[model samples]
Target: MIKAKQIVKKFESGTNVLFAVNHVDLIVPKGQFITITGRSGSGKSTLLYQLGLLDKPTSGDIELAGRDVINMSEDERTFYRLSKLGYVFQDYAILPSLTALENVLLPLLMLGLPDADARRMATDAMVRVGLEDKLINYPSQLSGGQQQRVAIARAIAHDPEILFADEPTANLDTETSDMILELFLKLHKEGQTIVMVTHEKDYAEKADRIIELADGKIVRDETLRRN
Candidate 1:
């Protein structure tokens, strides 16, 4: 679980101060799927980055699993992120030169997993994402959806406690996007905590809760009932 209190992320322009995320307080429970939705410049992505520890807020407190992370050192934050968090970005973020299996294997290896164990975990992740046949394929050879799946495989190979996705379906077609969302939903059902930022209303509806923001402030936080 994660908690944020009075989080404010500010940026200084030439003569103006911009609030990327202003006075935001949120709590994400374990085994929950939450989506942050807003129009462009609404601070949705900024808020995601802050919660993911990819960026620090100007002022606020963030507690991850009851540990204060707002003031963690760079090395500590890096270690924590690698060990406890997973991320999927809009851009796929796959290494073009690496095969799908290798891409997923790299992160597991970084965790000090032995080669055999990492290989097994990476292959299982690829299979879970329906990319087993394409494991040996390079990113350039795979379709956009396949590439994104590879990215997801890499993120989940280590089985982190939380998954953070930013506009994960932004570049995919409708069918492909649906496929990806289904995969995410499956993961959520299996008890993976997820926090995603997206502009698509339809995708947001699939989450357990949706937090709508405007002008860097959360205007509505709605918990949707699932059948």
Candidate 2:
């Protein structure tokens, strides 16, 4: 449900300009799990950020659910991000001071939902990620996998249309990474729209579609069917 056309992003360092994304065009269909794969400095994260409306392109256009975001006001973009998107990071990005359930409820709180209803939604989301028993646990009390599940729960608590994950398995061991990817696959089966940015090809290959980035451009795009 997202479309980008000839997106370009550049950063300035003193007198030099570095292009983070160069004339990239992409479309993320609804109900599909897509992955963007690239090495460090390949601009995968920049492209994801632009897609999520967290950042704007220097010269390009993006549309979400048929709405052109490049022309939206700042507040409009902010509202859309809060209402339509969820994010997961390699670091988990959970509040250390909050319980898993509470962390999941953070986004609902921002939406001004009643405390009881938010907690219920949070609990349900945590359960969906297989973290129901860890609701009362703090981030430090949980394993890396559990923490990532909490992040996932938080991201989906509001039933966002799209989830953007940046290097989701980078901080975990191989086995834990596998579990996380499996969880992602499960969510996709449940019709969650996801756009993941990862350096791991195995993870990207697991997605329904893979987009490869190099020097800020998409060099390859492939679609696959799972056996």
Predicted structure with the largest lDDT when compared to the true one: 1
lDDT of 1 by residue, 26-94 (tens): 998888899999999999999999999999999999999888999899999999998899999998999
lDDT by residue (tens digit), candidate 2, 1-227: 98999999999999999999999999888988999998899999999999999899999999988888898999999888888899999899999999989999988998889999999999999989998889899999999889998999999999998999999999999999999999999999999999999999989999999999999999889997642
Whole-model Cα lDDT of every candidate shown, in order: 0.94, 0.92
Lowest lDDT 10-residue stretch of candidate 1: 218-227
Model 2, position 220, has a per-residue lDDT of 89
Where in model 2 is the C-alpha error above 4 Å? none
Candidate 1 Cα misplacement greater than 4 A, ranges: none
Per candidate, the number of residue pairs that clash is 0, 0
